[model samples]
Target: MKKMILSALMLAGLVSCQQDFNPGTNGSSLTVRSGTSFGMCVGYCRQEVVIDNKNTVFTKTSREADKNPPVTCEKQTDSGTWNEIATKVNFDAFQKIPETLGCPDCADGGAEYVEIQLNDSRHRVTFEYNKTIPGFEDLVTAVRQQRNAFADCK
Candidate 1:
C-alpha cells in the first residue's frame, strides 16, 4: 500500500508540472504577424505582414485574385528592416490587451487581426476596424507600419 501511494503521488506531481508548462518562454525562434482584413473592397482588400526573428513578408490580396489571375504582391524583407520593426513592438503591452476587442456598437464593416508567436505561445486578437484599445492602437500602428519598409526592400 505504501509503494502504491508513493507512485500515485509521483504521477500526480508530474501531471501538475506538465499543466504549468508554457511553450512561449522556451527561448525558441518565433514570429509575430499582424494584418487587416476587410470584405467587399475595391482593391488590395486584404493585407498581412509577418515578421520572424530575421525575416518578414508582406502579402497583398486583391479582389481580382479570386478569379483566375490571383493578383498578389509578396515581398521578402531584409533583416535590418525587420529588426527596426521589432523595436517598435512591445510584447508586454500586447499581452496585456484583452483576448478579443469587440465593438458591437461601432457598426464597422471591416476588422483587423493581430497574431504573435513567441517561443511556443501564439497570441491573437481581432478588433473592429477604426476601433481599438488605448495602447493597442500604437501596437497595431507599429505592426502595420512595416508595410512601407518591406515595399522598399530590394
Candidate 2:
C-alpha cells in the first residue's frame, strides 16, 4: 500500500512539473524570425522565416539591383511545433545577449539573425553566418531546421 501511494505521489509531482515547463499554457504570444543574407551576392541574396502563433512564413528576395520581386510561402503552425521552439527560448538569458555579435556579412561571407518577440518585448541578435552562438545553439538549430524545411518555397 505504501509503495502504491508513493508511486502516485511521484506521478503527480511529475505532471505538475511538466505543466510548469510547457510554455503554451502561459497564454503569451510568441514570434520568432530567422534569416540569412549575403552582401555581395545576386539571385535570392536573402531568405527569411517568420514563425508566429498560427503560421510560418518563408520569404526569399533578390537585391534591388537584380530587380526581382520577393517570393514567399506559408503554412499553418501547430501547437506542437510552437511548443518545440518556444521551450528553447530563455528570455532572461536572451535579453542579456548583445544586439550584434561577430562581423556579420564581413567580406560577404554572409550573415544570419534571429529575432524573438514575446508578449510586449522584442530582441534581435545578428551574427556571422554559420557561426554558433555560445548559449543559443539549440534555439538556433530549431530555427534553422524550420527555415530549411521551406527551402523549396516558390
Candidate 3:
C-alpha cells in the first residue's frame, strides 16, 4: 500500500508544471541564491534569483516606495542550468571563501552576494563587483550568469 501511494505522488509531480509544483524546503538542498543592490537613489534597484534542482524564482524591484514597482517571475530549472550548477560549482572552494567577505573597499557602496545551501548548511559570500577578489571569479561568473538569465522577469 505504501509503494502504491508513493508511486502516485511521483506520477503527480511529473505531470505538474514547474510553476504549479512547490518543492518546498523540506529535504532538498543544492539551492543557489544570488542578488544585487546598487545606487543610493530613493529607490535603488535590487534583483534576486533563487534556484534549486527543480524550480527557479526571479525578482526585481526599485524599492518599497511607489516610485518603482516590483517584477517577479517563475521558471522551471532547465537541463543545461541544472547540469552546470551541479558540475561547475565546487562547494569545497565555495566554503573556503570567507563567510564575511563584505565590501570593505567598494567606493560605489553597491554590493552583490551569492548564497548556496548544501549538506544542510547555508553559505553566503558577498563582494563588490568592481573590486571582486581574485580566485573566486569563476564562481561569481557562474552565479552572475544565472542572475542574468532571468532578465525577462515579469
The root-mean-square deviation over C-alpha atoms between each candidate and the true structure, in angstroms, is 6.5, 7.7, 10.8
| lDDT score, candidate 1 | 0.62
**Candidate number with greatest TM-score:** 2
- Cα lDDT of candidate 2 equals 0.84
Rank ordering of all candidates by TM-score, starting from the highest: 2, 3, 1
Score residue 143 of candidate 1 by CA lDDT. 70
Q: For residue 120, what is the lDDT in candidate 3?
A: 66
lDDT of candidate 2 over 19-131, digit per residue (tens): 22237466356788999999999789999999976899999999773478899999998778888888888766787799899999999989999998876688899999998
Task: Identify the candidate with maximal lDDT.
Answer: 2
Q: What is the lDDT of residue 115 in candidate 1?
A: 79
Model 2 steric clash total: 0
Ranked candidates, highest lDDT first: 2, 3, 1
For lDDT, candidate 2 versus 3, the one ahead is 2
Error of 2 at 82 (Å): 1.4
How would you encode candidate 3's per-residue C-alpha lDDT over 22-95 as one tens digit per residue? 23333255788888877664563788888877888888888664766788888888867766665555556677
- In model 1, the runs with Cα more than 4 Å from the true position are 1-28, 62-81, 88-93, 104-108, 148-154
Per-residue alpha-carbon lDDT of candidate 1 for residues 1-154, written as tens digits (9 for 90 to 100):
9999999999999866442213234323556677677776676666677876555677767678665333334555565655554554555556777877885224437877787776566678778765655665665676767754555432
Q: Assess candidate 1 and give its TM-score to the true structure.
A: 0.59
